[model samples]
Target: MLKVKFNCFFWLFLLIVSCEKETVLKEPVIFTLSSDSGFIGSQLIITGSNFGSDKNKISVSFDQIEGKVDSVAVNKLFIRIPEKLTVGAKLISVSLVDKRSNPAIFNILKSYQVSTVAGSGLFGTKDGNGLQASFSQPEELTMDKKGNLFIADNFVIRKIDINGNVSLYAGSSTYGHGDGATGIAKFNQRISGISMDDADNLYVADYRFIRKVDLNGNVTTLCGAMNASIFSALLGITLVDNSLFVVDIGQIKSVDLSGTIKVFTGDGSFSSVDGPTESAKVIPFKITTDNQKNLIFTEFSLGSKIRRSTTSNVSTLISKESLKLNGGLTIDREGNIYTVNGDTIIKIDNQGQIELVAGSVAGYQDGFGNEAKFFKPTGLFVDGSNNIYVCDTFNNRIRKIAPIN
Candidate 1:
């Protein structure tokens, strides 16, 4: 009986050692992961032993959420952290068949949130009912660092607080340019574009004038008088670095803090010709600048264009085609261009691929991407947090597209 028991134990030991060898040889090993904590949709790089060359055989997951594998190599795997995941520690595991490697711990974070905070209508109305209030022909939208949203609604500048409270920040009911105290002052003319400087002061393009409004609602004409020759009409405005890029009647002009303005682009002509600054198409509608100080603006004449100014001040047409990209322009941190192309909001990625961000079928629905609809959506503002606030014009409301969380 003792001999038989010893034989059985020997066989068992051999089996255990063989199983260990198989595990060591066949199981994929994990050495390093890019980050232990990241927001949903963050790109994570995992590296180390034996991820395998055949990506089809491998699988990765965060907690119960399956990660979208961007790419896979023999020893490295690129994964986009799954979206809509709860914020907390999640077990990250990579596996091939039954050879599941030791799990790693990753923490998921909250990302940008997209929602409609105001307005509800098939065509929009100026309800003025606060949180559920609506807008009337909202043109330009800008945001301060403190989360306050400002809209150039018709001739008035309205403010939507962080808590979604709406109130008239500047301008009076009556239209026409009038610079004075807060409520008494009037934006009697049309406001084509509006932007905020580093100090949170607003630069408004009111027909023939560029007005400045302080925190206390003090309106001051920054540049361009009622008959200033510097601009025929100021359409789009953007504050970049320390300068303001304004789209005049036929050219893009750069104005210094002291109000000294010069034609930054446009060959002093408003034709559709693309050439050097002095010969480039001058009639620009909306203007925005990138981190590199490159001016981006849109034109709707001849071959409609989304033009960019090169470092050497040369004009470069960027939009895939000549489309009427009417309305506000903003660029993301990744250099993606977000603009209002009529009723739809389109995004031009760094690779120049145009994709729809919102507003497809048109008319108000206020749902997720593609599912959500807009009526003549125009004016876009991207905050420091990458939240996209859109002026749903015909809907008379501001819609926000919070990035993937």
Candidate 2:
């Protein structure tokens, strides 16, 4: 992974001041302008300049609708185009408070044929920061309640605002924490899986521990058993009725913000021991909650499946089939269950039916015009707007699936 580190301001300042070569390396900026994968929007970034100077004063216009600059630095700026330009690419003009630039043009590529905040990250590829191939991996991704993007690689988690500029949220080569896990764990201890609560507070399930993180990346450990069951590998989490649901092997456990644990179901084990010969069943991969406050879980099998029951009774409801090799599972506000298997995305109605929503993608290539397709998919989630965000894992892209008109 080639790590490209630059300040978002240096692009605009164009001012190079040399210190001890080490000091100049601290936090500089880098700037660029490009269109999105679907070409419906342009992701404009201004780096190497002091962007966070005035939050309210930061704004961008695509010569179309108004776009608010999400994050600014001495090195980068991220902005999104409007929904009107869903078909073709266009030239985009970006302006800051005192700096304005001409149209910077580029082709937009689709992720699994879906529009999302993370399209094919080829811009950072042909001329990139070093981890070009990794961006194409789409490994682990999360979207905040407001629809911002957070991508996790080997040692880093990036926070991407609506405007599109991505900043490093966690991880490092020598400082901060170790890069042993795919994502950041809570309290900077064990690295495990990631999730956001209803209030958008970040939660990480590291090994057997669960911890809360503040906006500035501060972590506070909450729950974990030192010598616990296989259920300690918390893969997914969902918040409902003022409680938190965790998905491990063989069961869905409920924990409160105050740190209490209750086994909702299973023989009391996780993936490592989910089998009868072992302890429980096949491990639970992801979990979600419906609008009715019911807990639902997705597990990998020949035909992927999800089990639902009353939170208080892992003993109450029946376990239903969801999909094969399910990755990420989430329910929309309309009570629809969404799951991803391989490159296929499916939607299940409340009546227990499966339907192909989008992403029957067939090929893998860094696309420019119309040659883009989906590859390995890892993370999947749904926003409040009914827009589906997919981490096209292998293709190093994040795809968004919208209803076709």
Candidate 3:
């Protein structure tokens, strides 16, 4: 009886050890990612160890947003980047059972997927949400740090929140010049350009005047004079460092914070000549600045061209024959230039190579890349995430072009 009992105890101990070994799982470990950066929907290969060959048991995420796991192996994982992820650096990780792999950093690049963020496609001033909102020939637009977009809609300035709600931000729609509260202030009928500073103070180019709107909704005339010959017709406006640059008829003018106006570039003649800053003549329509503070403007004369003005000299960056560039000019963080050519959006790289970003023929259809359409797209604003907001002027809508996943 004692021998039999000993045999039974030994078998029981062996069975328990076998069961424990079978149930134990090794924690997944990540060695490296095939690539550190890519656009949405792009595939990424994760290589590591202890990632078992069971695809159903593996999970992946980017910055806590779940990503699709295409395939999985013991030492490799194929993942599809998820959609609607905020552009920039994202932390990627893998999971198996209850254990997560080491986190890795990945960068999401800006891709194109066009969608209308506001406006009803009708010409009016009614404000609401999405299609419920209406705009009257919207032109220039700029966004604040909080993601609230301010638009130059006809004679009034409109605001659209990140949730797609639209309302009047400034200007009373009276089509004249006046300085007072936002609701009581009046802007000219031709409210050409708008820009915002780091403090959320808005600077607008209304006809021949440069107006400033404070955070308290108070409006004031920053610079420009109706009878002043220095400004023929104020078009585009951009803020760089301590100066605000404005496109005045055919010249580029700079206005200091105290409202001191000076000719920054161009000879104020309707011609295209690249030379010294004061001697260069460009029929500029819109103006913006790059990361290096280089003033970039679109020359509407002598064939459509994009020019750059340094501290003391001006040079032509891109020249296309009979392109008829619009007043839309924006630069990405990478210094790439985005402008409008008739009904299409054109992107110019640092090498001066031009590429079509979106739109083909004029219409009002939202799609991806060339499939998207814009009717006389005007002002463009690129946010921190590299997402672009376009003033689809004739469409009377504010459209967004974001990375597609």
Candidate 4:
């Protein structure tokens, strides 16, 4: 009888322990989120009960796209918004083992917000903030390390501070070729492109000449001259390391600080053959560099392609019949290329995937993503925060595409 009682007691104890374990492993329940809406790469904090302490066992997803868990606790999950999610309301859920949490509605904002940073939408040289400022054919844009923007505005170089204040950085109202102080120096009517170096010095493609403007706004001719045969037409200019690469007519040329110019790639032919520098032929325009220092440029012909020139050879990165590349080209810190096609801003990822970031029609309107409109948006610059600044040439305004707050 005692043995029978002992067996019953042992079985009852086992049943109780099993029930307790089941109670401990409860389903995750998300009660609140730090933010109900955010952009890609923004952090979101999820808080609720019964999430459990094991991060490996906890999984979070936004509309089935897995989010990166930055940190985790039993009742709280800190995660980053996942990329490639469609911009709209998405169901976010947390899963613990076989049990899933209640779905929470979270709105995903567009990757960028389009707004006018400066320019009065009129062609003039007035310098101020917001709509108080004006630009005359703003061509190319380059931002310094401190977030100050320099623009190649026809006959002068204009500057926009981080606070959106606009002022003339270089050149004079008189259109001519002269190198002196910022106020005294004169850039010809054709100021094609501008680039900045580590020292905040601006290297400008002033027609056939490459001019260097020091931090103190002193302009000096770096290379090329009226009588020099080294260049047919100076187009896009970019600074990679100690060398300045520029697109000259149908070829890519590199100019050293000592004013020495050499053929970096291409044989001055307009063909699209990709090979070693001697055998390659490219009709290059709007040159920039990737994180690997590989030269990237746009070829307006051959179905509008983006090509990369490595030390070994040149190759096509992206080529599509639908691309209408008419504006500037730039690369973000992540090596993603930002360029304009017609009135739209396009982003090409490292994997060659193409996405239209903003704008769908040609006009002058500011909104988000496709709702925005730009008229002949030319120069492009992606700042450290991934905010894009555009020279809306025909609109005569400098537009900014920034992250949603």
Q: Give the TM-score of candidate 2.
A: 0.58
Show model 1 residue runs off by greater than 4 Å.
Answer: 1-114, 120-131
Tell me the whole-model lDDT of each prediction, alpha carbons only: 0.77, 0.56, 0.86, 0.88
Range of the 10 consecutive residues with the lowest summed lDDT in candidate 3: 222-231
The sequence of per-residue lDDT tens digits that candidate 1 reaches over residues 1-405 is: 999999999999999999988865367777878888776655889886767777777788887678887888778998877776886898888887678787888877544444677765433334454446767778788888899988888888888888888778888778777788767788845588998988999998888777899998889887786776667878889888888888887778888878898877675465866666655666788888887878888877655678787545555456445465877789988888888887777778877777666666767765555556777877898877677998878777788987664
What is the RMSD of candidate 3? 10.0
What is candidate 3's CA lDDT for residue 395?
96
Clashes of each: 9, 57, 0, 0
Residue lDDT tens for model 3, 36-118: 88656668899999999988899998988999999986699999888778769999888999999889999986557889999
Residue 47, model 4: Cα distance from true site in angstroms: 34
Q: Which candidate is the best by TM-score?
A: 4
Better of 1 and 4 by lDDT: 4
Quote the lDDT for 40 in model 2: 35
TM-score for each of the candidates: 0.70, 0.58, 0.73, 0.75
* Local accuracy of candidate 2 as per-residue lDDT tens digits, 101-209: 5555544433223554544455232212322333525455677867677665433455667766555565443224222322343223323357776666666665566
